[model samples]
Target: MQIIVVSRHLKSARTITIMPRHVLGALAVFFVLVFLSSAFFSFISLHFRLPIVENILLSVQQQETRQTRDYITNNLNLMATRLGELQGRLLQLDTLGDRVSDLAGIKPKAADVAEKPGQGGPFLPAPLSATELQQEIERLATAVDRQADDLAFMEFKLLEKRVEERLMPTTLPVKNAVFGSGFGYRNDPFAGLRSRHDGLDFAAPTGTPVVAAADGVVLTASYHQEFGNMIDVDHGDGLVSRYAHLSAMDVVESQIVRRGDKIGAVGTTGRSTGPHLHFEVRMLGVPQNPATFLKRGEDFARLQRR
Candidate 1:
C-alpha cells in the first residue's frame, strides 16, 4: 500500500518514511493470532460438545420433562385414591339403600317391575370404568335420597305411635281402693253360681262417678236385662269398652267421651251387687284381658326406662 500526506500549515515541510514489509508482517501476525484463538476456542467447545446457550436449553427441557412426569404421576395417584374412596362411600350408600327400602316398605321388586344391575362383577370387584363409576354415583345419590325419605317416614311413624300411646287408657278401670271382683270366670253376683261372669266387678259407694277407661264414643247407653244400665264405648282401632251397673248415665249414646270422663254413677241396679261398676275391654267384640289395657301406661314407662 502507498499513502500520501498533506498538512494545511506549511511553514516548514517534514517527510515521513513508510515500509510495506513491516505492514505485511504486522498483518500476518494479526491473522495468525486470530486463527490460533479461533482454533483453541473451537477445540474447547467441540471437546465439551455443548455451548452455554445449548446447555441452558437442555437443562430447562430436562427439568420440564421431569416436572411434567411428576405432575402426571401425582395427579394419577390422587385420582385413583379419590375414586377408591368414592367407591367405598358408594358401597355404604348401597347398604343404606337396602335398609331404607326395608324401612319404607319398598320391596326390591314391586308391581312386577324390578331393577336390573349394570354389567359388572360383584360389588367387591376392582375399580369400575368411568361410565360404570358415573352410574354408581347416580345410584348412590338415589339411595341417599331414599334413605332421607325413609328417615322422615320413620319419624312420622314414631310420632303417630306416641300419640296413640298417649291416648290409650293404661290405667285401672276401677278405683284402686275398691275392686269388687277380679278378672277371670266368676259366679254372677245377681245370678246363681252356675252363670259365668264376663268381666270383673267394682264395688264402690252409690253415686260414685264412673269415668271412661279410655277415649271413645258411647256406642250403646240403655237398660239391659242382666245389667240394669250399661254403656258401650267404642274406641278407635277396634277397641271397645263396656261400663255396666250404673245408677244414672251422664253421657248419651253416640256421644264422644275422653279418657277418665264421668260417664255414669256406680250403682247396684242390674243383678244383685252393691254399688259397683262392671268394666270389660273387648277387641272387635271379643273379650280381652282388661288388666292388659289398664297397665299400658306403666309398661310404656318401664320401656322408656330401659
Candidate 2:
C-alpha cells in the first residue's frame, strides 16, 4: 500500500509505502488496546459496584440455587415413597406373625405384648422432612425383624406339637370292633365274681387286624401262660401299651413301630371265652384307664376336623 502527501511550502511531495509487517503491527497494537480497555472496565465495574454487572451475576447464582433445591426436593419425595412401601410390608408381616402364633397355640410373652400397642386413627396426610422420614424407616425395619423372629418361633412350636401328637397313643387299636368290658371294677368273666379289670376289651372276628395305638418300640412279643400271645410296646416317657390274646404276631421284640401299624391279629388265646382284644395302657408300670387316652385322641381328631 502507498500513501502520498502534498506540500506547497516545501515545493515537494512525500510518498509513503505500507508493507505487510506494518499492517500486522497495527493489528497487534489494536488488539492490545482493546484487551487493556476491557480489563480496566471490568475492574471499575467491580470496584464501583455497578448495578448492571451485579444484577447479571446475582441472577445466574439464583438460578443455580433454585435448581439445586428442586433436585433435593425430588430425591426426598422419592425416598419418602419408598419408606411408605416398607412400612406397609412391615404391617403385613405383623399380621402374618399373629396368624402363625394362633395356629401354633403360642401365647404371647410379656415382651411381645409390650412391643405391640393398639394404634388406629383417621388418615391425616402430613409431609415429613428428610430426617424424620429416615427415623421412621428405621423403626419400621426393626418391627419387621421382630415379626420375622416371632414367626420363626411359632413355626418351631408347631413342629414340636406335631411330633408330640404322632408319638401319643391316639389311634384306635382295632378298627370297627365291638366294645366289650371297659377299664374299672367289673364282674370277672373267668372267676364269676366282682374284680378290677385293668384293661379294656374289643371283641372282633378271629384273625381281625390289630394295629398299634401309637409309635413305639416293641418290648415283648411272646406267649404268656395266662395272657397267651401278648405284645408290649414301650412308648417314650415311661409309657407302655399291652395287647393280649393275639392270634397272630406280626411284629418282633426290639422292632420300631408306628401308629396304626399292624402288630397282630385278634383272637381269644388267654382266659377269655371269645375272640377279642385286651388293650391296656400303663404309665411307669402302673395301670391307667385306656379310655382317657382314647378320649384325648378323639378330641384331637375333632379339633383337626374343625
Candidate 3:
C-alpha cells in the first residue's frame, strides 16, 4: 500500500510505502520473548535452587513439615501415656485377683484353673521377649495370684469359725425363763447345805416345753432319781448338754436335734422346786458358765434370724 503525507509546517509532501512482513515478524518476536521470559523464570524457580530464594520458599515448607512432625510426636506421646495407664490397671487387677484366690481355699498351683479365662482354653503365657510394660503386667499378675491364695485361706478360716460358733450352745435352752440357780456351788435347795451345782436352773411353769440349745444327738432319754425325767444330748466338738427335772420327754436316744427344737417339758420332778427346768452345758465333761452361753434378748434374737 502507498500513502502520501504532507507537513504544512515545513511545507513538505512525501510518498511512503508500507510493508506487512516486517511488522508481522516483529510482533511475533515480541510475543515469543514474553513467553520465553515467563518460562525461564519458572524454570529457575523450580530447578536452580538459589540459596536466598530457596530459603524463603523453604521456610513455609519447613513450617508445615515441623507441624506434621510435632503432631505425630504428640500422638505417640499420648499413646505411651495411655499404655502406662493400662499397665497400672493391670497391676490393680493382679492384686485383686490374689485376694480373691486367697479367700477361695484354692491352692496357688490350682489357681491355674482360674488363671485361664472362664470362656475357654488354657492359660496364655507371656512371650519370653516381652516388652517392659508387658513384663510389669505379668509381675502384677503373679502378685495377684499370691494375694488370692491368702484371701482364700482367710475366707476358709472365717467360715470354719462361723460354723463352730453356730454349733455352740450359746442361747437360752428354753425361751422366757430366769436363772433360778446359776452354775457352781450354792446352798443346796433340798439340804440347805453348800453343794456343787453342775448345771443352771431356769424357773418356769410346769409342763412348759423345753428346747435344745444347740445341734446334737440325744445320748439318753430315760428317767433318773436325781434328774427325774431327763434328756442328755451329746453335742459334738467334745461337748455334752443335759436337761433335767422335766414333766415329759419329746426326743429319744440316738435322735438328732437342732437348736430350738422341743426336747421336753419343765417340771419339779426331781428336787424340790415349785417348777423349773434344769439346763446344763458342759465342755469336755467339765461344767462351764451356763450364763455365758445363755444369751438374753436381741443377741439370741439376731442368731435365730440367721
Please name the candidate that would achieve the greatest lDDT relative to the true structure.
Answer: 2
TM-score between model 1 and native: 0.51
* TM-score of candidate 2 on Cα atoms, chains taken together: 0.67
Once model 2 is optimally superposed onto the true structure by TM-score, how far is the C-alpha of residue 193 displaced, in angstroms?
Answer: 3.6
User: What lDDT tens digits, residue by residue, belong to model 3 across residues 135-205?
Assistant: 65556666556655656666777688667666778757666665577778999877899999888787778
TM-score of each: 0.51, 0.67, 0.56
lDDT of 2 by residue, 225-252 (tens): 8788999999888899999999999999
For model 1, residues 218-237, the per-residue Cα lDDT tens digits are 99999988778999988778
Best by TM-score: 2
- TM-score preference between candidates 2 and 3, better one: 2
Model 2 ranges off by over 4 Å: 1-82, 107-124, 298-306
* Candidate models: Cα lDDT each: 0.72, 0.88, 0.76
Measured with C-alpha atoms, the lDDT of residue 125 in candidate 1 is 50
Any residue pairs clashing in model 1, and if so which?
228-270
